[model samples]
Target: MTSWVDMPLCAVDTETTSADPNTARLVTACVAAINGSEVDSRTWVANPGIEIPAEATDVHGITNEYVREHGRPHDEVVAEVVEALYVAWESGRAVVAYNASFDFTVIANHSPGFEVRGLIVDPFTIDREFDAYRKGKRTLADVCEHYGVRLDGAHSADGDALAAARLAWKMPRVYHVLALASADSLMESQANWYRERQYSYIDYLRRNNRPFDDVSVEWPVRTQKATAA
Candidate 1:
């Protein structure tokens, strides 16, 4: 039994300019945890080189103009974020993300020029694996709604990431009870499932008749405007 206290874990989340991991730029990143009644948090914002679209800006609040004026260099900030995340993992802790595939893919796409190694516990995939037969979908919001978890900050990277961490903490103990597999095993299982079964997570939810609610109806204030100066 892995007690939450015994688990060296960090929650990670990223808010990007778009949904495409290959093209979207990471605008914000955050890591946080609640340890025995004590909460700790860290966050960073970067100026992705690509243009921050109006639609994207409407969601995250970062604009190209503001980024140009106030944001740190994208690569430098990403390096810092990676360093912080790696430190947490190297210390024998697991990095947790709501939908790790999205975040990890984005990181990998942007980090081709750098090196990073760690296993991320993507609770999204885990939930789908655990609830494969339940029909519909298991989005972070849906899961949070089903489990009575309060989702704060919506699309803000830190807020979403922290919510994910809490959800990971509350994952039904039944999961941990099964074979105590390594993180690699879990990832492989998810990848195999995705490859073998063309399971679009959205389709899974629709089939299950689970309600799909938009996690963010409107963006947060984290983004800046790049409008005419």
Candidate 2:
């Protein structure tokens, strides 16, 4: 039986135009394949066919002018990204991301025909579960720092994605329980972990008289509304 650490890992991430997954447009994306110590990465930049807001550009450092000059067509980039993910899945590798829900949701919305397969690993969810009581932020940079993983470019899709894969590789070494679980089991566990976190936050909101409806428990990607049959 292949241990979790020995299995191949495919990490995906995207830099988008907004924080809301429903509205954000993908500006850049990266998919990385990791086998033991070797990694191969591919990246794409697209002119999302919409304005790249100053705020979004500030985070990812990709300006509208720059993308217009260098990026490929939006649909073309989306297709390639989807194909990369499909290849990774077909290779029996686990797909990883730091905050998977946002990245996967944006991609699903953009590439409507693309369907993701294989095990999904989320370092963000796993970190929350393993260190539930730990204080402060849990951003990719923070988690990488905690695990002593080098994150060179910070918000760039390629940098963040590779760092996430490295962090996932380090997780089992730090948490023995993670080493005991298979990829499928870990995926299911992450779903439950996210649900518990959302419930706790909802309770806090209600206690403070704040609106807390519409929270989702889905992992990797939230369930979208179905078309009328």
Error of 2 at 71 (Å): 1.4
TM-score of each: 0.76, 0.93
Predicted candidate 1 versus true structure: per-residue lDDT over 21-135, tens digit per residue: 5467788888775465565778887888778888988987878897778777887777777787778777766678887656766676666554435556666766766777776
**Full-model lDDT for every candidate:** 0.66, 0.85
Model 2 deviation from native, Cα RMSD in Å: 3.3
C-alpha-based local distance difference test score of model 2: 0.85
Top TM-score prediction, candidate number: 2
- lDDT (10s digit) by residue, model 2, range 76-194: 99889989999998988889889898898888888877576878889999999989998889999988988899998999999999999888888898998888887777778888898
Question: How close is each model in CA RMSD to the real structure?
Answer: 9.4, 3.3
Candidate 2 wrong stretches, greater than 4 Å: 224-229
On a 0 to 100 scale, what is the lDDT of residue 206 in model 2?
74
